[model samples]
Target: MLDIAEELNAWAAEGRDFAVATVVAVSGSAPRRPGAALAVDAVGTAVGSVSGGCVESAVYELCRQALADGRPVLERFDDDEDDDDEDGLGTGLTCGGAIDVLVLPVHAAGPVRPVLAAALAATASGGAVALARIVTGPPALLGGALLVHGDGTRHGGFGGHPELDDTVAAEAAAFLDAGRTGTVEVGGRGARCGSPVTVLIESAVPAPRMIVFGAVDFAAALVRVGKFLGFHVTVCDARPVFTTRARFPEADEVVVDWPHRYLERTATDARTVLCVLTHDPKFDVPLLRLALRLPVAYVGAMGSRRTHLDRLERLREAGVTERRLAGLRSPIGLDLGARTPEETALSIAAEIVAARRGGTGVPLTGAHTPIHHDGPLGVGSPA
Candidate 1:
């Protein structure tokens, strides 16, 4: 949802109205990721999104209804959602993906705001957070939400029974540190044995991380661009003299250390990005060698086609393979005809985004693969 819970809490705090649209599940090709969201405020204001366009207008209308009646909605958009043209947004999934959405009308709900605010803080600060929504019945089921921290303690609940709280707390603790979402079945506790508790657990880290090795001019520029693109940018160079706070002020931390050793200790998750900007072969060769060994999401080394080719041969002699070598975005960046440092930075950033999103940077009409891949739910997969 990308800070969406916070947005709803904010809207409620101001006495303004907002509706949360959630993608509960999907059965076919879905354009947006599962945690996709769209929030509409009292005055038709909106934040976040649910789909490409097929059902957003319907969602907005429902948001208005939610504001009017103070009600929560569970809406499912199925394969038959081919209706057209509402509120000038038009309709249809040109990408050919079916999606499901759940819209909940929001009120301050007292602790709902503070609990979710704590959640937002945990997410923004790189800590993990989880929430259990008693979708069916509860001591406070209908509008109740629980916030669990990464460490698995009772911080806040939907003002429910202590038994229900303890049961959900223990069951949900494992999910707190796991930055993925899932459905946990907590039906054996005191509240009711057969009734289920649906926990929506989301653990957000401090943006995707990118450590640029060797704080040269390109390193400085890459740090700025990386931060703009929501990376926890770090600038590292072994030579303390070249690595300075003044050269890379945009960087979150300027470290003077051998790049390979630092990443080996800190990098985790496929979301981490590593950029080796030192053109010097002594540093670049080893940096590239180390990056190839990690499971990071993206790794790019700054150098020319010739320089990259030569480095690859050296890597091959040192026993690195073609599969790993293919992962490197050499002569890094897009085909943006970038000539200067700033332009090159933009191109590199664009390429990274494209790779992250699985986009080919080509026109949709000319592409053969479906615009939308099978989302987490595998909406189109045959059962």
Candidate 2:
């Protein structure tokens, strides 16, 4: 699957056959979402995970079986009370959820290997691509796949009907545009007359951006955290001497331009996060004036209470609206009583994640709220 594309791409480059088990659907409280996968090579080596360890062994065996038989298999694992085999050998999820996995082999002579390999390569290189596979359909088309690139070009087909291939490609392109990985239900043969087919479209897009507008020590630590959270982090500052690649090696880019000037020219989207660690009013005021108006996911500034109040007055004088100012997270990061740079960076990253994931930034120890939230406040929510 595209989730483990880097490793699987290497396997394909080496001409090693492997079986990939991808989660096509889930019901209830499943750990992994659609497109999560686990792959096993012909030599018994495994990489990646489909269920975070709950149903890994069973899925591993399924991958091995798929590799041996050269046939695709769809298996469902669910929590069943009737089963008494409690040695942990049962494939049920301990979280009481259900997941449907589709296992397909990628042998050297397989018809779909080239398509899969091309998808893997594109995904590993951070290019936009989508892999659409038939999760539920006729036996002949069960594991058929199509690779849709960002430019709307495609490779491979279901081989069932041209209409079906066309329909899936369009649907996959839509998913790719949205950077989503999930399933779409369509009638067999691309019309509503026959049995329904569920196509799992796995989309891979470049990571979202996290622009840290200060080359301070805290920014260094924050860059590491941002990378760990799968962000394309950039560190920007006006001072050339302070903003160097050596100071922030983990950052994807180190830009030596005035914060506001650089941000004006660079690109940002709803998923982009802006962190203004340059507490100086000269830098913070101009940069934040532009940042607060942009349609970005988060905009936080690092400063003390007094500094924040003064900065707010300066922004007010700079013609920023109250509505726009409300979006700023001055004194950035949750109140963690953090003193060290690393701890402060952790707190800042925590607040960013909380905003993106719809968390309350409160202790979960005594809270009765749902551990996972899937509402409008999720990633890419209105900023």
Candidate 3:
């Protein structure tokens, strides 16, 4: 749902009522992840996707039903084609998997509008926000939602009971801090153990940042690739003429400062990526020294094997430990025999994807690896 937050925001601003169907859980080889959403507005307009195509009509009808009743519903779709006989709606997915979707109606005049507005604003402003909704609970509590900001401020209400609301709020805050999106089950004095309440915590975090150091032609091409991969890309160079926005039109930011100094004062998280396109020692050595020490997801530099060795020695002299040096991906990008700037950018983007998803940068045809490995039911998915 957060993926289409802007569209929802427009509807909310116009005081329009709409319903959303969000994929909350997946099993086996589902097409989409947990946060994938499909929304339908009052006039029957739809946006976003949940199954890529399969089962959309059923989900859309469910959204309309939810909008009409002012209630929420949880619908499950399986890959077994035989199941269609039971539902008569042909809601079975052909992806040979199963998914659970929650159809929730958002009222423009309801208490949740402010929270939705906040979430939409956060997406644009590069802040983090979490939205928690009750998917399985008593009739009065179902579909209840609460919004929590990074600074601990909260809006909206849930569960009707203060104890229940407090418990869910605390849990939502914890997940928000971790930047995780998933479901949590609660049952206790405020909620019965026999009948548990499941809450879906959806976190809308800022796009993972991709800092491209050196505004060369390769960097300009890579900036477009980074943005296409849903990153907030920034191109930086000490040279004012080369670091202009006109050169890298798609970059979210163009910084005209020394690469090392810019990185020293910028903020980064585990999902952030640092790409050093400047192979020169004057720019590469200092910036890499800081990049390697940080906790970002990827740190790669473009250079030949000999250049990499020289850069490594310089970084070592600058006090970067051997263990930290192991994190660097020098001569950055996969070996694809790339010659053009666009081709080189593709290689780098491919390598970045491989690193983030734990792929081996090898052909999958002969490999025995699972086609999907990030889902909850994937072979090595986290417990």
Model 1 residue 248 distance off true place after TM-score fit, in angstroms:
3.9
Ranking by TM-score: 2, 3, 1
Residue-wise C-alpha lDDT for candidate 1, range 158-181, written one tens digit per residue = 564677778777656765443445
**Root mean square deviation (Cα) for candidate 3:** 3.6
Output the number of the TM-score-best candidate: 2
lDDT of 2: 0.89
TM-score of 2: 0.94
Q: Write the per-residue lDDT of candidate 2 for residues 77-146, one digit (tens) a residue.
A: 8886326656736677888889999999999889899899999999889898989999888888888889
TM-score for each predicted model, relative to the true structure? 0.74, 0.94, 0.91
Candidate 1 TM-score versus the reference: 0.74
Query: How accurate locally is residue 1 in candidate 1, as Cα lDDT from 0 to 100?
Result: 46
Per-residue lDDT for 367 in model 1?
75
Better candidate number, 2 or 3, judged by lDDT: 2
Q: What tens-digit string does per-residue lDDT give for candidate 3 at 70-107?
A: 87899898976545456675668888899999998887
Give residue 97's error in model 3 in angstroms: 1.3
The positional error of residue 231 in candidate 1, measured at the CA in angstroms, is 1.5
Against the true structure, candidate 3 reaches a TM-score of 0.91
